[model samples]
Target: MHLIIPNWAGVPANIGALATLRSGGVSQGPYDDGNGGGGLNIGAHVEDAPQAVVLNRALLGVLLPASPLWLTQVHGHHVVDAGEVDNVPGAVEADAAIATRPGVVCAIQTADCLPVLFADVNGRVVGAAHAGWRGLQGGVLQNTVARMRASGAGPIVAWLGAAIGPGKFEVGADVLQAFTDTAQAPEAAVGASAEMTPAARMAQTQACFTPIAQRPSKYLADIYQLARIALGQAGVTQIYGGGLCTVTDINCYSYRRDRVTGRMASLIWLK
Candidate 1:
């Protein structure tokens, strides 16, 4: 299979977009070799062959306008400015988000963690973020949008890429409590606030406005909902994508389903 993510209908006039699928690359067994089995392990740390990672990236390179800003994702909230980025993934430490001048491609790698691409309708700037529950609650999207705005971008449009869907993402009370403060957040997408202890609510206000959804005592959060609330707070409304589920779709990768799984990349740039 070709690593194609049609999450977004088209790359907006000023913006360009493409996210990688798990199939159609190098590696073997659980990682698939082009011989029609499991394949395309892009994560360098996945115990796959280093040579294979290089080769897979090389194949991807042929399609990108520039090298992707691969990050060491630890499920935290840190958005780095691409211009100030150390020209390498290591120098820039952030779990979710990369912004670039024009040709700079902001890239995010994920297996199940959501990869979100942001671009102004005019395409003056482009950015990408990794929005795992922690990062989403931690405000990675808002942080990234802030930087992009500094560059005179945003109130932007966003593309929410694939990740584990809610039906599969079960959680505990802590996760549900994470969003109490989001009431103060510019907005919340239904079920955002339930009944938590006053202390829990205070903690939410102090920490970051982390929105983790819940069902009854525990909300079965739709990560997409969290992203919407968070981005909406940052004045980002024209969001797109958020349809595919990595855990269910074999074509995409999923960390929750299989911890040692391949990774996919979401990229955005200005044309």
Candidate 2:
């Protein structure tokens, strides 16, 4: 199956990370690759054929050390320990997962939503978070970094995976207000503005949302910039991989582009 090995520098040799593309599997119909071939749809809860998902996951399993710990993402800020839910029978409800031990893969499935992979400089711990707009606004990345630090990680770095690009991600006034309100909140300025004044930080956050002239209260929201602001708030500055756009990149799946579609997975683990 096609995969994207993160090009992050200073990543320890023992940390394994990859983002899957939508190709090289047995799924058909809407789940098939955009080129009319089989797709590597890894999400089992997207109404894809059960047997097809099984076959596709098996195809992906050949490249990994063990089965991935999948979560029932709710676009919330809950973070879970991968080792605790790796082999569990039922679905674990969380937006992010962290793994401290080797062979326990932390995975996040996404279509148009952003998938972020995390690793410390020393590879002591790794994490994966599914950050849609809701999750981003809810502080998922900050929570993930916090949990990683608590689990003995140091100086974390993050890599953004495929998602809808800012040019194509249209949003309403509520979306703009949500971020603005958060940026102006007293607690939000504490760590995020440590390097700058609260006014400057607010400007940085507001700059991510550009007004759409044709649409009265709509704006083009840059998910990547929003994520950077969130990470900055958590004291993580070394970040990478934010240019890929699932909506326009045929190699990846986009739920917004196609209402009914499969999902791609971003995974990270210690070797």
Candidate 3:
């Protein structure tokens, strides 16, 4: 199976992290691997053959330290403790998970949504967040950082996983407004400028969302840049891995490119 081993620095030696590509399993049809071979479809919720998904997960199991705590992501800001998860994969309703204990793998599945993996410099905690636009707007990344801090973590670093790129992630005016509004409070809290009014702050947020010249009221939102602003507000300055784009990368899956596609996974754990 193809995998992306995060090329980050300062993470403790015991922390292991990787993001999977869509290949090297038994899923067929819409979930087929890049070369039409058996694909690794980890999401049982995506309507692939149940047994095929089961087999794919079994294959994934060989690589993990333990069963990854997979959540039923609602694109909300709910963050769960992976160390506390004991039910089935989809039973927990959350978009992010953190685990301070060893052997508990925090995992996030995504087709086009951004998957972010977090690790403290001291290696006391690790987390994974599924940051789709809705979840991002609702504060999922900030919540994950807060939970890690509450768990006794120190300075945190993040690895941005594959997602829809700005070129393909076109959004309407409402979506633009959501992020603009969400960006304001954080900027203000960081002592942006007392002289800056709400309108100026909103204008500052526009840098992350570029209007498409051909499409009125439509924009290309940079999920990576938006994530950086959120994480920066949360005090996570050491960030990496925001270069890949699922929509254009065949090795990854993109729901926007293929409505009925398999899901990829990003997982992190402390050994």
Candidate 4:
């Protein structure tokens, strides 16, 4: 399993960018490593052993910036400042996290939802967002962008983590409508009506289905495209790494593919 991380233009060169894949752990059964067997499954709530999860997390910490701020992610639009979590562990509940000060890591865990990392050119501010269709349509992306703006960060580099890319995500008319119904929500597509509509929604959604072709009423939803649209709404034109399909990649966990699968954490921090 190869871990992938993409750095955006707004992020400073000194800052490190990385994302972990399913490898190096003590979990047995389906979560097993290819050759080593019994891979690292870091989520405590999963069927994987709690001690194994702790061990996996410890192994991950070798490269992480201190301990990562893990959120109790509920697919909502809430964005919290992890910089404020100075007290203890497992005390934060947020769908999105931002770290403006250095030495702090803003992390997000997701099996299929897009894990978006944001940072400014000066490395003064960094952020992570767990953007499923609901959170994206709600306002998580815009909320993160607003927070980054407040920190006097410019360019606002964004890296799209591994997610259910367009090819594997199938959605009904409701999801097609999710990004378009901005009046019902906010900063959603947050763009023009001509580009995103009931008519073109299917075409737009079907552009990425590889092995799994587009179905009738539903279309293959591209989390990357949706994220780029959201980032565009956030006035962030320079985005990177929208090319991963977690659902298709067996090495990665995909809630869409397996509802009970463990999650992968995408983390970013200032050096």
Identify the leading candidate in terms of lDDT: 2
List, residue by residue over 191-235, the lDDT tens digit for candidate 4: 442346444544553343333345566667667876776677678
lDDT tens digits, residue span 92-132, model 3: 99999999889999899999999999999998999999999
Alpha carbon deviation, residue 79, candidate 3 (Å): 0.7
Question: Quick one: best TM-score, which candidate?
Answer: 2
lDDT of each: 0.71, 0.90, 0.89, 0.73
Writing each residue's lDDT as its tens digit, candidate 2 over 1-271 gives: 7889998988899999999999999999799988889989988888999999989888888889999887889999999999976465237899999999999999899999999999999889999999999999999999999999999998888999999999999999999889888887777865657767667867888899999997799999999999989998988889999989999998989988998899998999999
Q: What is the TM-score of each candidate against the true structure?
A: 0.82, 0.97, 0.95, 0.85
Decoy 3 TM-score against native: 0.95
Tell me the alpha-carbon RMSD of every candidate: 5.5, 1.2, 1.9, 3.5
lDDT, candidate 1, equals 0.71
Q: Candidate 4: global Cα-lDDT?
A: 0.73
Off by over 4 Å in 2: none
Residue 211 of model 2 has an lDDT of 95
Off by over 4 Å in 1: 5-11, 33-38, 182-219
